[model samples]
Target: MIVQLSDIELTARTLVMASQILVILLGFTIVYIAFQGYRRNRSRPMLFIAVGFTLIIGVQAISAGVYVVFDVSELAAGAVSQAAQLSGLICILYALRMEG
Candidate 1:
């Protein structure tokens, strides 16, 4: 048997790239806000957001890179997906906690 990058895989790759980009952007925003808060002598909750977002983005990028460079094994794909999801969930929880 042989495996190749199908249309679905391509679409998934694109989605992952877009998601990572968004996460990075959000991380940047968090860092910027944190800096501003520091200058203003306010609570720097944005730092936590930045850390969470960074973790999510980093994990996602790693997963996407592995998917692109390695063989498309089911186990590898599943692990990447799970890592991305868990990181994303953690980021969301952190964001919500900060906002609340």
Candidate 2:
């Protein structure tokens, strides 16, 4: 069966897709900047922070892909992304304590 979208619906979906791509790109940029700072400072805690940002990037990209492929609810997708982000941050905190 063929699916039909109104012009407004098509435009909205395109905009949502564009925003998701921008979010993914910006998240990776953050991770790259953090990694570069870690390299320059030789700081393990900064490395952990970079790792956390990497996880955030993964969440952004994977959650968007999941939403597109599986049509998950916004609440569910946000929950999944938040859980990943929290996990990464907790690990980073632990690494920071160890570095201290």
TM per prediction: 0.47, 0.70
Q: Write the per-residue lDDT of candidate 2 for residues 26-89, one digit (tens) a residue.
A: 8788788878988998877778877887787787689868987997998999899899889888
Q: Which stretches of candidate 2 lie over 4 Å from their true place?
A: 66-82, 91-100
Write one digit per residue (lDDT tens) for candidate 1, span 1-100: 8879999999998998798788767766765675576467654455455555555666656666677798777677768767765776676576567743
Error of 1 at 42 (Å): 8.0
Model 2: residue 40 alpha-carbon error in angstroms: 0.9
Best of the candidates, TM-score: 2
Give RMSD to native, each candidate: 5.3, 3.6
lDDT of 1 at 62: 66
